[model samples]
Target: MERDIGDLTIEIDRTLCIGSGSCVGLASETFEIDEQNLVRFQDETPDIDPERLKEACAVCPVDALRVYDGDEQIVP
Candidate 1:
């Protein structure tokens, strides 16, 4: 994906994430756990379904998820 939404990006703060699987359950194709069991980006900049992505963000229990657009803007 070309980050069509500007600097569109998603970041998981390992420190804040509690392995709740909310992000994974919501967007499995875009988020996953590595061999070390840490959540990692399936795509540094995912080719996302905007509405679904937003839902994933909203459902994250710890607010560990962040999505940024081209100008580093948050999309609702």
Candidate 2:
């Protein structure tokens, strides 16, 4: 799943996620761990800093989280 936040786009690959809370620890207001321990976006995500989002995505050990700027990927 993905969402456009300002000029950046954030995505979560549920299949690739390993139930790690790295992204949640960095951006709780933006990400959450579901009952199945998968990462998902908050229902009402606020305006998040692009760099913060990138940091959260980068912390994913399984590379399940991703951030993109237009057509270019900026995070793992």
Candidate 3:
């Protein structure tokens, strides 16, 4: 599933995720790791600080997540 938070759009590639928990750690209100160890958003439009969202995306060791702020990429 894809989620939009402010100008940022977030998507998690479950197949590529390693259950790092980085997103949940940085923005607990916005993200969580399910029992399957996949990243799941709290909602379709999670309520979280933009800076914290970007920070979480930046820390993912694997490129399983993508967050875009407009046309610019917040995560690789």
Q: Whose TM-score is greatest here? A: 2
Per-model TM-score versus the true fold? 0.68, 0.96, 0.85
lDDT scores of the candidates, listed in order: 0.67, 0.91, 0.82
What is the alpha-carbon lDDT of model 1 when measured against the actual structure?
Answer: 0.67
| Models sorted by TM-score, best on top | 2, 3, 1
Tens digits of per-residue lDDT, candidate 1, 23-75, equal: 78888877777776666667565467877876786687877777776557463
Better of 1 and 2 by lDDT: 2
Residue 67 of model 3 has an lDDT of 87
| Per-residue accuracy of model 3 over 1-76 as CA lDDT, tens digit each | 6787887898888888899898788888887899898888875444678887888877889978798878788687
The alpha-carbon lDDT assigned to residue 62 of candidate 1 equals 79
| Clashing residue pairs, backbone N/CA/C < 3 A, model 2 | none
Judge candidate 2 at residue 13 and give its lDDT: 91
RMSD of each: 4.0, 0.7, 1.6
Task: Identify the runs in model 2 with alpha carbons over 4 angstroms from their true place.
Answer: none
TM-score computed on alpha carbons, candidate 3: 0.85
Quality of model 2 by C-alpha lDDT: 0.91
- Give the true-structure RMSD of model 3: 1.6
